[model samples]
Target: MNLSAAPAIEVQNLRRSYGDHVVLDDVSLTVPQASVYALLGPNGAGKTTLVSTLATLLHPDSGSARVAGHDVVREADAVRGAIGVTGQLSAVDDLLTGTENLRLMADLLHLPKAEGRRRASELLDRFGLADSADRTAATYSGGMTRKLDLAMTLVGGPSVIFLDEPSTGLDPRSRRELWDIVREIVADGTTILLTTQYLEEADQLADTVGVLDGGRIVAEGTPAELKRRVPGGHVRVGVADAVELDAATRVFPDAVRDDATLSARIPSADDLVSVRDVLGRLEDAGITSASVTVETPDLDEVFLSLTQPAAPSRTASTAKELS
Candidate 1:
């Protein structure tokens, strides 16, 4: 994750349209080297279109996209060489064993025969599929199938990986395990561009998040920064009695008080130092609160605020392609 180097992925003024229906509109963003960047959007928000264009699967009508320093169009082969893609659906062949699947990917990558075998073995072990390596992929569980699919993406040792909703249907435990795997990948200095349905997944794994809406990135920043952009942050102080509550309210004149809950909600940025300052000032005024809690807007709130207004009524068809 060297910030000194050039970015791994960059797009500028990208636009794509299908029969006069615009899917991507003036989209632009950059993904730093060896970091995880998550692109989030509701159905029809053009997330998949962006990923496709960047991966060199689709051509943009106008504008430019580059991956791993190679232009996706003029240098498609170089861009392809530097990247691996794991799409929303599992790419595993049902009849092949987990070991066979890895071997297949290695063969596709044109690795030497002996090297392919070694690489397959390493991936089987790395993805925890060693025990079931010889078993057909058809019988593998959802989590196992996902791991095998992701492992296949790594057969070429790509510097940049595109994961398009890689954990879409996994259970909670499986999802967390996938997140752990993502962390490991970025730690090895591999940049990843992930498109996911899970907001919590972005919050947990992304160093930077881009919120796409109406065929463009509506917002892009660190999770905390985006959350801070939305309003909802405050500190709630619960006092022991009405006397303490009244004293705290006077100090925080703008606070909203709730007599029934014996609490006062003071609008704040919710940073640690600010929260501590509020508590210290209350203590100096000889008012001790029963409890103090800080609440900030979460990704759900940010997502809602940013996309809800522009979101179209989604359908099964919209989920598959850009609007």
Candidate 2:
């Protein structure tokens, strides 16, 4: 959040092209340390390209990016040393046991043998894989496999992590479970740059959100700030009959009246004070509404409004495409 401090991830006018097609065009962003920054785009709005570029998996055609204070292109080794990446698919070996997977990561990190064993044990317990530590990943549930994959990523104690659609095919329960794990990771001061298609996931986790579309970042802000930009919040009041409906409309002159449902859709921010204020006015006017429902502009609405006409679509293959 502090502008003066070096960002965990920073990019300026980043451009990437494949053959004759542009995959990323003048993309720029900054992710603060110890915060979760979500890059939201439909299926293929160049989210993967952006992440891969930041992770030093791909070099930009122009501009510059830094990860953990190291230039992604110039100091790629340092950037790699400070970051971890979990792509859409589980990277764990199906034949390897849970403990073996973590051990493999530890070995790749070049940790001492004794330290590798200790780290693997800790990760198995931390990710709730202790009971299944000896079980082959082939027999693990979808959620378990994901946890192990993420645990493997953390074996090196990275300062920044990149997650590309971490919850792609997960069930709702599994997704929520992964969300909790993500929260815990951030709480530990590991900055994360996550690319996800789930609007709710970004809404729930991001300290800042960048909406990417057609290889460009169209919007950027906190979840609440983005929602406020699109005017959609309202309160709907249902009344008994024409008389009550008429009374409601008179009280709320700008309300959109519904004759069939005997309801009035009143323009409101859908906050507590606003809801109470509306109800108080209706009460003062001696108008009784049979039911009241509050609705607000969510990420879905903002996403649709911003990435439209040219909705998120797959572009040509980048240096590393998520298959």
Candidate 3:
């Protein structure tokens, strides 16, 4: 990511409400150019509201947001021109052929007829949809349809894309394929703001993560940094035999011993310094028959620890409010 370049998206004390129900409260974040910023939050946590506000589909009650160097409210048209949005629901029209869909988007953007056909062909080929170009979207599989929807979003060559739960309902393999596409997009210098229910998605794609809860950003940092905030991170040293286990235990007396696996679990912060210290102590004791690994709490744990469970009523009402 280019630290010298101005941020692709910036928000300051952004707030939104529907009557007495506050959906987004004082949400603030920044997404750098050519990077992925993943927003993780539970249902009814205002993730969609925040994204809608930034995309200019909805207005903020207070605070401000700028996307692609344009204020979301005052310069809504310019912001819309510079960004593309892929909502949770597929935007593919079932009756249209894949090629037709791309051409339609091109028409909406007012591209020249010749250029529109050129872009349609390029996108179909780029997204591996050339063979299915004439196939109606109704015939496309879930994964293929998703690829096409994303492809249409790129027809205008948006500098920044908003992917709201892009991988939702996809199988594991399809989800991974989508992740690869996201990486490719970022590599080509397009900034992405991704909101996902899958915590693993954030861990894989995000350069920075912001955890929203109860209409506010509860935490923000890199995946590793957030994981470090949670407890239960430790290092496990595997030994060859019971004799080696005893020797290892002597080196790390505080470490928990597992006789069955002949490993010692040393509670540590799972940082580089701690790993080096563990290895150094083992070398000092001449315990050579050992394998070491560091284990830290995953994003799931970090998310669980930071956010509260949504009430059933709030979940229903929040959906209606956003709609």
Candidate 4:
């Protein structure tokens, strides 16, 4: 990707502290144009602090942040205009209808009366809140409330959006619904900076993921790259018959057989070339597989291993306060 194409967000030597408690330490990061960057850490790992600073909601003590090419501290207003923040808490006004809520946001953005109404209706439809447009937000489901909150954030058409644990407290279906919404939002060429404790969300939505621990980034890379860093990749293969399995067991001296399923789970790297090699070997032996699957290390594994905790008792809230 064009690294020089100007990032939607940029941070360097980012340091924040409260008294003697340091929340962030020389944290440097870049968010590419139109790409989704997931900032992940357990609760109190300073994920919220980093996000708030990037969104121009808070100032960093020593570090620098730029959103849409404007310095966050010196050009806070410019940064606010260039980016939209969907904070950890719902911004939706509970007394207003969905349409009314969006209109309120449009009005806050200084859109014309007619233009605000047009935009409000447009967002109501886009976020699946059209039918509920007239209904009070108090009666809306958690999923609906989140949709409306996100729609309200989009009224000004910001190029960058910061979502800080946007799916918190929702059921699985509601979380999935919000995930689809995020995908749609990014598909429209918007750059997203999402912070969440849910690893699955990051694994599913992020183009690049940065894992933070103890107020600093421990690792930053694509999902596959980060997975490759940990162990536990395997290949589970099903055979056509017991004879084929027996033959294959002999073919590969070190194979673990499952008597119930008539399959062998091979210990191997779960990479493309390795999979192709396994298939090629089966083809050479004139053997066919009833099924096959590749399993690798997931976020839980990666997080536990990477986030070794610089100091076991440090609080993420302390870090947040420093920011």
lDDT of 3 by residue, 219-265 (tens): 78899888876666678999889888999999988789999999988
Models 1 onward score TM values of 0.85, 0.79, 0.84, 0.80
Which rank order by TM-score, best down to worst? 1, 3, 4, 2
Tell me the deviation in Å of residue 123 in model 2. Answer: 0.8
Q: What is each predicted model's overall lDDT from 0 to 1?
A: 0.85, 0.85, 0.86, 0.82
Which candidate order results from sorting by lDDT in descending order?
3, 1, 2, 4
Residue pairs with colliding backbones in model 2 are none
How would you encode candidate 4's per-residue C-alpha lDDT over 1-323 as one tens digit per residue?
A: 55448998999989887678777877889998889999988887788888888877778999798888889999999989988888584579999999888888888999999999999999888888899999999999988998888888899999999998988888999899888989998999899999888889999999999988777787888887777665565667788788888877776566688868988877663233266677778767877654667767888787777675556676555443323
* Position 310, candidate 2: lDDT: 47
Instruction: Tell me the lDDT of candidate 4.
Output: 0.82
Whole-model lDDT, model 1: 0.85
lDDT of 1 at 105: 88
Per-residue lDDT of 238 in model 3: 96
Identify the leading candidate in terms of lDDT: 3
Taking all chains together, the TM-score of candidate 4 against the true structure is 0.80
User: What is the C-alpha lDDT profile of model 1 across 1-323, one tens digit per residue?
Assistant: 55449899999999998986788878889998999999998776787888889989999999999899889999999998999888674579989999899999888889999999999999888888899999999999998999899999899999999999888889989888888888999999999999976789899999999988777777788987777666687788888999999899998898899999999988774343266788888998898555778777889988887664443463323322431
C-alpha-based local distance difference test score of model 2 = 0.85
lDDT of 1 at 130: 96
TM-score quality measure for candidate 2? 0.79
